[model samples]
Target: MNVRKFIAATARDALRKVRETLGPDAIILSNRGIPGGVEIMAVAARDMELIVSPRDSVRPPGGTDAPAGGAAPELTRGADRAATRPAEATLRKPASSWRPDAEVPLPAATARPLTDAPPGGEGTSAAAGAAVVPAAVMDEIRSLRRIVEQQLAGFAWGEVARSEPVKTEILRQMLGAGFSPRFARELLAELPRELDAAQALAWVRGRAERGMLTIDGESDIVDQGGIYALVGPTGVGKTTTAAKLAARCVLRHGARKLALVTTDGYRIGAHEQLRIYGRILGVPVLLARDAKDLRATLHDLRHTHMVLIDTMGMSQRDRMVGEQVAMFRDSDVRTLLLLAATGRGDTLDDVVRAYSGLGLAGCILTKVDEAASLAASLDVVIRHELRLYYVSNGQRVPEDLHLPNRPYLLHRAFKDLPESSPHRLAGVEPGLMMAGGGEGMLSVGGQRG
Candidate 1:
């Protein structure tokens, strides 16, 4: 690759030089400070691409200036032009003592063959056998790129914190309330920059509230009357939520129209628990061990106005989750994933991803009363765009289950932790948390209104 070394009194100046010369498409190979200024090694993006994937540089055995078939003509022209140009040449010097006095030329491209010719000489086979970049080299390049990107990101986030204190504060508050950094950052990306702290907070709240998908009265499952399955990870209160839905259905359409089914034969007494709920509500409880049994049971209960299935609750990592999803999907049962409000943010994300194969009809928030904060649950819901159907806060079959209260939920989600709370994020902790995980931190200069 034709790498060039540029030096200036500051990184910004050095980068400007790179951009001016390389058309803003230069790939920074290395950047560091020198004795009196900053030094950067960079290559034109097009040149780097040729080296990165050398097939475009490979020529036919006839020795003509033709690239292998399927290579871009522009790239071929550039490769030819590069062959005649003198690469950057500079004396190697210790960065600690080096000074920017003269231009340093890159090494000749011919010295480093883009692709190695096979023993039979440069032939069609040689063109086909293009050089493969070493895994170690690629890994090192990625590591270097990531380090540069993170450094730039940290600097940019620091700038945001300085210039947009309200955004930074609200981000801290969101993290303290257990909202994922990805969601919080995304929601705040559109906040008008002119808004004050209170206005910004209000805007963020309004945005979050609007993003949340909730079930309306007309779309309530009990009123609509169809087969629905409550599915989620173990200990998320799926069985209890199922009973609550059953009771609601019974009250709305009478006991004859509601039937309870359990696919949780794995847990001892699991069926018995659903059967108890059924008996108390004067509803019939049936067991369906597998897909076949589930199909037959659904066929038998076709006349019922509503059938609520309590599925086996396994760990999201359990392979059987896929099977359960397939069973419900094949039976045409709409699934409502039961997510515990108290679960950790990462755990909730995992559950949603695991059960989201064939797609969920919606989701139900469980253990709302037990959670210290509803931000995590609501965050996942809004991000995954899952429709919130019901909120289960207590053990009471019907009394505790109610339609989603959007206002209350939104209020609870943005509720800050107590000042004395140890879990509350303060100072730079929030910024670090948002920037720590590499998964979803927006890049520097990313879209943020």
Candidate 2:
């Protein structure tokens, strides 16, 4: 393989040289800082094809293929016995023809991290001579790429801070509020790029609110009564949210119009808890253990104006989640995934993904009163396009479940963290976070699959 080396003062310049010399499809093998500048070793994309296919053994830069007798003379030298072994035959290269410049120490990227033998151990010399690249080398290349990207991100961030201080501050605030890196970056990417900090922040709020899908009073679930189920991961307040919705339904259309059902046979006091709430509002509570039971219960309550099924709380990773979803699949049931406002962004994302298959009618934000920031919850809701049905801030059944207050949620989402708080990112950390987002940072839409 023809592996060419390029040295330049900066990573950008070295990359440009690689692209110009080897075309855009060039594969970067390794790169690192040297005494004068950075050194990058790369090979043509086409050349990499030869390395993987053992039949097309690695050929020297300007030499013919080795004779059928065996590898070239230099490969069988006394000091490099490993190269002569049949095990290393496919990767055998004439040692005399290929050698990196001696100006610097060996490149760390060439070493194999996964092999039983350590990177610089006995077999490394033979492994290096073998042209087939190991997975570890690719990982090293990716690590270097990330480092370069981070450096570039730091530079880009500095430029933005100097030229667009308001935009920079808004980004910092969004990240501090618990919004995902990609979400915050996408929103900021579309900002007018000319507003002051206050104006920019307002713009961000407006954009976020517009992206949010919320139900108004006219389309309120209670007013449009139907058989709805509250589903979600364990301890996200599914039973509590169900009771809140039940109370709201009772108040609007009367207790006779509302019925509560519990599928939580696993939890100790699950049925009794919903039963207590049912008694308070003069609503009857029913229990359904499985899909067939749920269908029968729904059939029996066909005349009831509204039926609220409080499902069993299970981990999002549990296989029963699919069973629960399947139970409501063929029925007229529309699911409302209960999301806890206090959950982490990734955890909330997982919950949304796990329950999204229910053809979610919408979602209810539970435990809002306890969340430090609503940014993470709002992030998942907006990205998944889940209709925001209600917000349950407190345990109070009828009073706590209220229509989503868009302005208040937005305010809470973008609210900055205290400067003294350890959770708050400071200095160049925001830039690093955004940079690490990679291709996601460049994407305009914030939605994720």
Candidate 3:
């Protein structure tokens, strides 16, 4: 059974992708549009077996609950006759009498629609797999699908989640912890049937831990040498995060090995805030008023082990973000996005999409202390394949920011779960951290083979 999510620029393109990944038998479960394109959720025909049995499979002849053949019930006899009628008819027609172009009527429920049929024409022939409904008919079908998917997106998710106990429990935990319902559904769509509830949850938690990239770099990134800049939407704590990074680098490598630069002349005292932190940490702070100044500053700071740039905060809607990204890209600066965990999942998704072209060097999670749930932030990181280098929960210089062990963070996601709740997932077990983890969070400039 295989369930997958696909995104593309158009319905046609997305459906084509669905066919390629999930095969011709894929059933589209849901779809909706986002910032730049469409998102479609589909399950392969085999995956649909989880919901319904195969049509060709038979479960013993006759009604098994019946008496030992006192007599087959009348309804049962009728069903048996109906089932064999088609085969009887086919056998009665000799091959020599069959016409090549003759159209045989078929039951509408079992009939395969003809492909390439003219608009409004009756279906006359069947293609290999697709029902070649008229273009207008297809359009109407797709439109109806979209409507149903949209309506079903929010309503009645519980009924689907309740199909199986283990998955239901896992879904309860995930939803309670603030994970998106779509994300929760996809995660547990293919649970192993053999495992008990505890083992299943352990596997799920282990899976989530593995998907998150937790690095071992000294203080996340400052230990490794690089010219980097923190970029994100306003109020995500980019400047504060920059200061925290600078402080960490200063502690390990000393003030002499690092430099602080700011390109935030737009905000009154933006540079001043970093400058104050620089003074406390005894690191030099420079201001780059524009891209020209930024390039010049990078040239001078080339001798430093790590140059941490604090760029101005702007809404993702601003054009300045692209300009800043351009500056960082041209100067060989690794850009790190500061994400606010407190923000809504959709906003986080939007921010990641808006800044994705920056060639992000991983992410720094901020405001973990404030967010009611980290699900949205984590979801964005995992879905976008963004590397998470560090997390900050407070304003205590380098003290609040550090790289968390993947298991520790994964455990924290489920820490507040109720013990008596139907979904009692005991945090991600420790041993599985290594056995089931390590698929994400690459170090700067590193790629998984």
lDDT of each: 0.72, 0.72, 0.62
What clash count does candidate 2 reach? 0
Query: Against the true structure, candidate 3 has what lDDT?
Result: 0.62
Evaluate residue 139 in candidate 2 and report its C-alpha lDDT on the 0 to 100 scale: 46
- My TM-score estimates for the predictions, one after another, are 0.68, 0.73, 0.59
Error of 2 at 132 (Å): 6.8
Off by over 4 Å in 2: 1-146, 440-449
Segments in model 3 whose C-alpha atoms lie over 4 Å from true places: 1-163, 415-449
Which TM-score value belongs to model 2? Answer: 0.73
* lDDT per residue (tens digit) for residues 1-449 in model 2: 99999998655567678878987666666666677666878777667445344332234333444444333222323112221121121112211112222222233433434353333332344433443434444444445444544544454455456556777788888888899887887788878866888888999999999999999999998888899899998888888888888877877789999999999888788699889888889999988999899889999999998999988888999999999989999999989999999999999999988987889989999999999999999999998889999999998767888899999999999999997999898876777677555443223222221
Q: What is the TM-score ranking, best to worst?
A: 2, 1, 3
On residues 369-398, what C-alpha lDDT tens digit does candidate 3 reach at each position? Answer: 997667777877877888888889998887
Which model scores highest in TM-score?
2
**lDDT, candidate 1, 96-193, per-residue tens:** 12222222222233233434332344443333333223344345454554555444334445555656777778888898998887787688777777
Which of the predicted structures, 1 or 2, would earn the higher lDDT when compared with the native? Answer: 2
The 10-residue segment of model 3 with minimum total lDDT is 440-449
